[model samples]
Target: MVDKDATAAVSRSEEGDFVKSTWEVTVTSPEGVRHFPVYRTILKVPPVVLRLVQGELHFESALEVLHRREPVASGVLAVGETLRCGDWELSLHDRSGKSRAVLECFTDPFYSRIWTLHEQVTRVGRPGKRENELEIDHPTMSREHAVLSWEERGPVLRSSGRTWVDGVAAAETVLADGALVQMGDLLFQFRLLSELVLARGGLCVTSLGSFQARVHGELVTEKAWRTQAVRWMLARLALEWGRPVAVERLLDEFWPEMPEDKSRNNFNYTISTLRQVLGGSEAILRATGSLQLSPSFLGSHDLVALQRTLRVEDWGAAVELYGEYLPGCYLDWAVAMRGSLEQQVLQGGLRLLERYEASECWPEVLELGGKLHAIDSTCQRTALGVLRAHLGRGNASEGVRFYERFREHLGVELAMEPSAELAALAEQARGG
Candidate 1:
């Protein structure tokens, strides 16, 4: 059930709410050290109708006309009141309401672009001086990499170069209605929007990797949040999603430096602004002396997802989802939460390393070991796992080199010597 008003708002823009996207944020720590979060942006590219070459005409004619920028008869896109764009003859109701296609190219949580699949065979590859293909400006992309063709079943992708569908290498794969395609270093999602049902009304908040809040698939832009206080309030509540925190507790966490009377006034105003930005009173609920995000409005939070993955010992998924908690935020609550989650991810990485070692999966062990080591180089277990992985792969010289680095790092950083076990492993590597 998409919000009609929100969808209407989205339809009016070509790039959706990204015109005023949140790009970067800076926050100072309590100790006065300023932190700048890496650049990221939220994009809500709208879907467009997918049209084929009109009847009895060769596809080349349509292609030539489209290249010439001549207006064709792309129909009204009905996802939001039947909006029309370009001349591709696309509409939500076109082809029995299955004519919409969305190609979303995402580099990270912060950067993304969306394009409609209009051509019969959409060429994808590195940009050329005069080539008319979907040119991906990535170092890893080849000159003529792949082709995406519109078929009766759906969008079919074919590639001989490096290509992956849903993370598995594939030369040719018939893309599902919503398939994740990775070419070179960029990721793209192909979706037949008309064939998919809209999400049930809820607030989907993303805080890890990037910050975005979507209501029933409609993005809540930063402009809508007129105050930083309001954004902070929402983030705090989202951290405790569905759980109530005493109003006093929130006041203490957010404004411990201010006087109670002034803080309370600010808190009340922040809450009002938050509810309005989220679009209704039901977004936040008040009862007794506590505040909570209404459970019905909470959906697919990244932090919650990471916690669940950790609980189930899904180390790989947990590691993939882990990012700087509340980037650019040094607020007290955010700091505490960041430390707690970082420790969890660090521990999970160690466990995952041990699993990889046990299975003699040297590559996975090395990859995961490097990540854990970056987090905490002093962790003996991680260093040992990495050393063993290097040795297991028959790279004894590499193992010895890593050991030398680790031994020196430990002595200089912690004024400690490597344990006897680690020394013995290095000796074994030396002998080999």
Candidate 2:
């Protein structure tokens, strides 16, 4: 039996709009016990839970029931309890506890398994049978290996016997997102779900063009770093987001002219001021004698996102991320970083243009080529790409116009004539 009013309340919640909520659950099948993250809407009226496993969704039947004699609100499920709906049953656990987090294992024997960290201390080793939270039965693995526990700052992993982080032998280290953890022959990638959730909707630093930070899609002008010192500091930090930047290195790079003692004091003051501007001291952390911008405070950053898309071979998205890198900033470091990113964008754009040309995707090639030309007006390769894309589409007039503009740009900027290849392309377009 259930309370009709409570049931009606839950029904109303389901009928309303949807909001994102994350959950950790375990599903037992004939193969074994598997754990994963479940993203569900605020309303639980459908009595179904959606599980995301390696970016794929699995629809599993679920039920809403009273837990501890209290009505289970929409999007709210009790921790450490198993509920049955239809033929499927799942045990839910709270992942937002003070010390709770999740570790996703990607090695064989337990690939795609999500390990819930609930206790103050949990161990990772090659346990006999079903003994450990994470078990890897390999010849290279020791019986009792590493320990994972929560610290005030974040989660930390310490090797009890033999373990490695990113191919380096480490006794203890603070776990970072995408860190490769190796024990024996088994390797796993670590991601803090708490950090991921915190990063869902927050400040977004756009560094591809002019540097700016936005909160919830709105520009944060009040906290903008106006001074050169503060602006450079924030730029450097954003460039190395999710990693620590040493104080000595920052001082050497940004303020080498100042004396050591004075520079240190000034750096300290700048850090304090930055924290105040960010609206919280926790946004910047001073740990292990280095500074780290909290990943939780970052929603999206163009540079980081561009690198990710490039890694995945997503040319369209990579092209979209391509823009003027740190425009109008004349600092030496900014100039160097900008040049490096420009080269990367050019190479990526050329690759995409070649692919599109092969597929006869003239419109896409034109779009990408035009963007590349805008970024580097004197780039002959980009000009050729645009001209060819136009010609392929039979837009001879547009191709001639592009060639004329490119020729003019070359003459004005370099005081040189267009290359033979470019001149031939324009001649062919005019003849056509």
Q: State each model's CA lDDT, in order.
A: 0.64, 0.64
Kindly report which residue stretches of model 1 are placed more than 4 angstroms away from their true locations once superposed.
1-198, 218-227, 408-417
Q: How do the residues 121-206 of candidate 2 rate in per-residue lDDT, one tens digit apiece?
A: 77777767536766666777777788887788667888877677755788999888656676765556565544322224266787
Residue 35 C-alpha lDDT in model 2: 60
The TM-scores of all predictions, comma-separated, are: 0.51, 0.61
Candidate 2 local lDDT, residue 342: 78
Q: What is the lDDT of residue 21 in candidate 2?
A: 27
- Residue pairs with backbone atoms closer than 3 Å in model 2 (clashes): none
Pick out the ten consecutive residues of candidate 2 with the lowest summed lDDT: 10-19
